[model samples]
Target: MSGNGWLRPKKSRQKLRKRGLDNPGDLTTISSRSSIKNGPGVSVDKDLPPLPPVAPLQAHRLKYKEAHSRIDTQRGENRDYTALIHALGLEDPFDDDESWPRRERDEEGERPPGEPVVASLPSHLWTQIAGYLNPKDAVCLALASRTLYARLGKAPFEALRRPENASHKLALLLTLDRYLPRHLLCFPCGKYHLRSQPGCEKLQPSDALVRNPVFVCPNARNMLRRAPRHRIAHGWSLPFSLVQLATRAARFGPHYGVDVDALARRWKGKSGDSEDGWSHSTRFLIHDGRLLMRVVSQCFAPPNLSPSGQRLLLFSRDDYFPYFSVCAHWRDGELTQVCKCALTHVPEELPRGPQSIEAKFKNSLLMGPRRPTAATAPTLCGFCQPMRRCPKCPTEYLIEIKLSEVRNHHHRGGVEFRHALVVTRWSDLGDGSAPSTSLEWAACNGDQAGAGYDSFSRLGKRAISGIFEAKISSDNTGIPGRRIMSMNPGNVKGGDDWY
Candidate 1:
């Protein structure tokens, strides 16, 4: 016996079995007889009935076990692709289960058709009713029925087609949202355009112009009527079509648009001429009929940066906005100040020996305090160390200093530990309505409504960052950190160098 005191029991220490007792061989290779040996096989293999060829494999994995299986079916026998989904006896992916009717039926039965009663009403009554209605409503009422369409004629539609009533026409077109699943409302053209790429549409790089079009538009090249887009970061912007796709799918069914997972993305930022660079990560979630967005931006920091150095590190040269995502009210808040404060916490190395004669004599008497190194943990002050929500918009921010392993191409192992400044932002992008109309969408862009966007009133107690983080993480208890507070307590903006 090998005398090792810590040796485990023989059963526990034995190697994995070569052939699994809990498994069964392939269906094609199974023996004609049932178990002659005492050991039983997988529960699935016992008393299993024979199945048709290639049912277990996917469409991409199809192969001919027998030549008869691949008969081209000129005699009309091929079931084609109706046949991985059905073989597994699963419900069709495109099928709508609930399938509500266009108009609600009464409790007694379906609503009685009233064509006779509608026809009995004089034509002048509709004209009288339409006179009190707006262009949008008038057009909708006229088209509601065949009887009404004949009586109202083309007057309401002609009125809506006028240049001044364009908004009314657009509103009228928006009503087709329920009817058209393969088309998107084109705002600039005021029409429903067939989706060029349809369900497979993908978000592309801001610079990759040709790869991003969902539907072709006549006004695409017209500078005055460009596509609506929201800025995500320095060079990244999300076009409105993608939002329409996501919301349409959520509102209707899977076939209507792409999954929300299609929008989640991770990408690196460009490091141009300067050594200081940023990396941005973004993900999306839909909650309460509203789309939420989270962006995390991080960059390595050196110790004891000057005012100019901080500016050079944070802001971009072209537009002056930071490389991270931010709402319209960024400048009015304490966001920049909080970043500068975190930078101050990055401890700078001090000289061991005192230069002055009095300091040298004082140091000789007692040993100096323990010196701080680059790896020392940074401690942030109260003013800058809490979760902050933008008082103006439905957006929140959290700034943190974390010790991260950075990759360096020049280093031997191509890795080194460094302190990085991480800024994370969460914004509610609204209920996927028209960009100009949705308050959340407009507010995030700094488009004013009356006084201004009051995020406290709009979002209430629910912090977007907290809700978003809780959703993706394993734990559902809640965000385990500091209480959320206003980003700018003073509500001050402009004219200050401190920002």
Candidate 2:
């Protein structure tokens, strides 16, 4: 057995040289599959065991080269490239499962102990770090951890809810806290003013939040300890502004705005008394027992109204102006902000469709106090008139409201106001569509109160109108035999005197 370490091609050296072929050239190598025992083969038979899957590096193999040589070179190159890739831990292209090594934990194992337990800290600690991150980064972190996502629910709500930060507040308001357990996460404020209802009391401790030592707000601790309980009917109108309404509409458009950052800011940091020093709140007049306050700015607090009804209908940016009123009996329950609507600058043509419409307060009069009256329905043939000045005499009061847009046909710039009186139930104005007869006002007196009149009329006409209205609606005529009085003639003497 005369043996050679390596086999040479059968072609003579002289012939190969004549053909200008080199060692790497196509004709200089063996062609059979068995010749490539060290590398992948070009299987000649369809039934032959499948050649090992082609290595990615084999894509560059020269087709004209001897099949066995090409396979051997490709196999060596693929092995080297694969080792390099494996060292870097790059993804295996053919793998269906894309999971990669967890870099943090992998690196942790490589290091000695006492370096730092960064990788294994409970997820909550990571969330606390995320909280301090910018919004974009915080969102990334939230997506990475289910635990972080839970803790971050409405996390940014506080940032948007502060008074000066109304633009953001509007954004949060329009959002629904879908993550919360109750589908509701009420951010109760520390202190607020209200119009007094003599017999009402504050909420009980069980009904409100109890003081928690861990709470960030100092006042919350004291409030929790007091477990304050008192009746609540009326006292102060909530602090809401026009600005907040407009921004809300802009931020949310048609989407949800529930954000934790906004709630936290409004609850823990911002208030009516903010650094801006702008008085964004005002005390509105209570006419006929109905509270009225117009929203007119960009930054403001949400109003507080008792929830006495099932569905609270809020109108945001109504007809370009933001206006809201509660539904029937919503006021019978404790005060809480339900759904938030985005605020928007008044549009040119106020929407008149279903979207602009809201539930009107039922059994509520827009204005007028609750008290007994003297004159009863004229008793047929016999009568006893109660003393007009008796405590039972229903006190009559009037309030005038006027409104003009920033620009109007009359050249008035900014909002303009006209006046009207808060008249008691006096008459039925044709249809039940009178503005003063809105259900909000009805809550105070319902059908018992009369329609209100614009602050313009001759004295006799005013007196007659008031008398007729009061007699027909209240079932009482005049103050203890005194004839009804009309509008003051002095009010219409001249343009300057008009109110």
Candidate 3:
């Protein structure tokens, strides 16, 4: 009887019989394996829960992003960069003058001897080749190999040490920064000093610099060995070390240096010789491998000022420099005239005209108060209103006369509205390269060593006042319709026009 019971069970047979499928059929859910179209393939059913709609979290795009992260330069990701560094120098970093992908010694510190071809070259030939190179390049050439170093000897290094070659020597030292993250290059001493404050260095004003020396150096008190800084207004100057810090963090990683926001500062000088009653605020931004600085200086000015009065208001009595921030080449341009031209636009209250007392009384009653003559902000002329870029430096200036509110404790209600002159300077400090090698920094400082920085050629058409303002334009006011023009088309200097 057990052997004869090979058919379906009684309950199953009853269910199949009830559904009229006692025998399996093609494409039936009960025994779909018999389907001729596709074996074990799922069939659509309204009552069945839908197969999870193709998961996007781990799709093909996941691998694509993983591949992209391997080569992204902004985040400083590099694939086989150690191998590539054995190729050409950093300036021509991607160039390859070898037959194979170069790599360094293994973990055991074992490397093959110098190339036979390199050793075979005559010393005179190497000397001749180095003769055409600058001091920095010559040093780099010597450091490339022991064979080259022996051929070049100490001549290149000796030449780099001469006082005249200070700039060149600094350039050579800056290239070694990657190997020494715990040190910062001292431009004056031409050496890398151990960082005193390390990751937590703060940039202070010129007065309180004793608190945070970037490094301890015997030249700290030396007047000539002062850390290089750009004058941002009279009392406030930006130390170049902070520029190095901000840019290094952007290029490499955050732990190497401080974030850009940490460098931002705002302070008011109420009782200083140069910046009395002036307010200065500085902001920094990193764009296109360069550090952009914006120094906004504002000071309240009285309306209807004479030429002498304008000079007294704009120029500080101590140093005779403008209270606003400017580059070293400010004197050789129309920047002074631009500021003066903007000052002339301050709306002046004219003498009151004789009016009908009855009409005046009626208007006075109708209006809550008589409208002031200088109620609206003044508009500057085309010559002065447009942004002016220093032709010789990577600096741009915008002079504006705006109506600003000032709170004075001596006033009746401790609040007053007045016209103020605002000067905004934007500069593109170069890409953390040595100050001597950075064209923008040297050009801004008017150092004769870097005369090759043609502002129009290097920066192109869009660099004027854009690098720094691109960040805060949504919150603060921005220059919308203004065009950038050369500050000094004639390049005239020390002339009556500037005076």
* Winning model by lDDT: 3
* Candidate RMSDs in order: 27.0, 25.9, 20.5
TM-score of 3: 0.66
Across 290-408, the per-residue lDDT of candidate 2 in tens digits comes to 22222112222222323321122222221211122111222222111112211111112223233211222221234232222233111211111111110111112221111222223
Predicted candidate 3 versus true structure: per-residue lDDT over 123-155, tens digit per residue? 999999999999999989999888899999999
Worst 10 residues of 1 by lDDT: 9-18
lDDT winner between 1 and 2, please give it.
1
Where model 1 places Cα greater than 4 Å from the true spot, the runs are 1-113, 271-276, 349-375, 412-415, 449-451, 494-499
**Rank order (by lDDT, best first):** 3, 1, 2
Question: What TM-score would each prediction reach against the true structure?
Answer: 0.70, 0.17, 0.66
- Residue 449, candidate 1: alpha-carbon lDDT: 44
- Worst ten in a row by lDDT for model 3: 11-20
Model 2 root mean square deviation, Cα atoms: 25.9
Model 3 lDDT, residue 23, Cα: 30
CA deviation > 4 Å runs, candidate 2: 1-64, 68-178, 181-499
List model 1 lDDT by residue over 53-119, tens digit each. 2223322233443434644557645444566447545763454335665354343455687778888
In candidate 1, how many Å is residue 344 off? Answer: 1.1
Give candidate 2's total backbone clashes.
Answer: 92
